[model samples]
Target: MTTDAGQYDDQGEVPLAGYAALASVLATGVGAYALVARSRGVRLPERLPPWDVVLLGVATYKTSRLLTRDKVTSFVRAPFTRRTGHGEANEVLDEPRGTGVRRAVGDLLCCPFCTSAWAATALMCSYTASPRLTRMVCGGLGAVTVADWLQYAWTWTQRTAGQ
Candidate 1:
């Protein structure tokens, strides 16, 4: 059987092994959650309420953006990413660096869309473990998300008024 690394070796610089490793970690986390829940006799909710879904969605968006782009969090990504430039709203633009796992992690850390899945998974797990706490945390992030949009809207209004 051809390994992912060897198979993708001739296909250019794709980090198949690194991607596999990341996938493994995600799978392990999910599997562990399932096992622990089962062992503890914890029941899965049939479905999340629409309001909860909306709150979680906003929280995921903000959390992913903070992790992937916020300047304040650059230290977390600095080891794996190189600062490319500045982004709007106190965010930084970064490009993945290094090879294999390092580059893969950098890619994940630099792309909000890519990080959203991880963030959502973590948030969902937290919600499952503690609904009240998760809702509080999500509500705070959701509020921040709304405040960010309001800030942008206010800036736009001021710009238009000045014009």
Candidate 2:
């Protein structure tokens, strides 16, 4: 059986790193949701506005920045992860492999895609618990997201035009 570059199942031991991290994140999200629901006596709304979707998208981008940006990640792991290299937007740090849970969490935090799910859940839960504030925050993020995309589009156009 042909295996992918990162796949290790052919070696008789499958890597549990991703699954473990996902499960940990999911479990934590559920617990947080429960806490919020209990404290606020809130339930998921039957429907959300179209604007809310945009808000969620923006929140995801902002959350990804917070999680994966070098400066932010460095601050998060200052006491644990050691500097290993330099990343585009932040200093890259070595995972705390010797410290089991911290290493796993650091891996998750260092990955924007991995952190998106957590951010989404938090934003969604907050929407139910505090719709007004959530929307305000989301609105700010959504506006930025739109502006960023427009900037990228303009830059691409200028580059392609050979100006």
Candidate 3:
């Protein structure tokens, strides 16, 4: 339903799925906070890299792709989605099971944009808790992120060059 702000809002009885998503986000935040606290206690490096935000953004992008998409999630989305096809791109099947916590988690898992937030939180907290390992992982993912963009750009160039 549309709210007074002219934005989308839930109508009728609020779905538990929405509640589940909200709770999950809050819980994640609390967990991140705890990690930060522990990092401080352990005298870990709290300062971020020079381009840490940008790095995390790239890492989140790669992580989202790993979580969502077809072939990637096919191996992991069981009990939530039916696994079908022969590991092809469009083989992963999503089975919507009405409104509930499971549905909420399924939705979150199916959308990279949604999952990116969770990934970013985890990466950010990890950076504080263990900068060395976090940087290694994020750096590698960031490299892949750049490679992905370059591949897209290359394809676009090839197509446009023909014109």
Candidate 1 steric clashes: 0
**Candidate order (lDDT):** 1, 2, 3
Better of 2 and 3 by lDDT: 2
**Per-residue CA lDDT of candidate 1, range 19-98, in tens?**
88998999999999989988987787888999999999999999999999898999999999999999787888999998
Candidate 3, residues 60-83, lDDT tens digits: the string is: 988988777657466576655544
TM-score of 3: 0.69
Cα lDDT of model 2 by residue, 1-163, tens digit? 7987777668634326755866887888889878868887787778998878877877887777666655755777655456676654233544433344566566667667877888888788788888999988888877766776788798789889996
After aligning candidate 1 to the native by TM-score, how far in Å is the CA of 30 from where it should be? 1.0
Pairs of residues at least 3 apart in sequence or in different chains that clash in candidate 3: none
Instruction: Give stretches of model 2 more than 4 Å off.
Output: 1-22, 35-39, 70-73, 79-99, 150-163
Which wins on lDDT, candidate 1 or candidate 2? 1
Candidate 1 stretches greater than 4 Å from native: 1-11
> What lDDT score belongs to each candidate, Candidate 1 first?
0.91, 0.71, 0.70
Q: Candidate 3: misplaced stretches above 4 Å?
A: 1-14, 21-29, 32-40, 43-46, 82-96
Please give the distance, in angstroms, between residue 84's alpha carbon in candidate 1 and its true position after superposition.
0.4
Best model per TM-score:
1
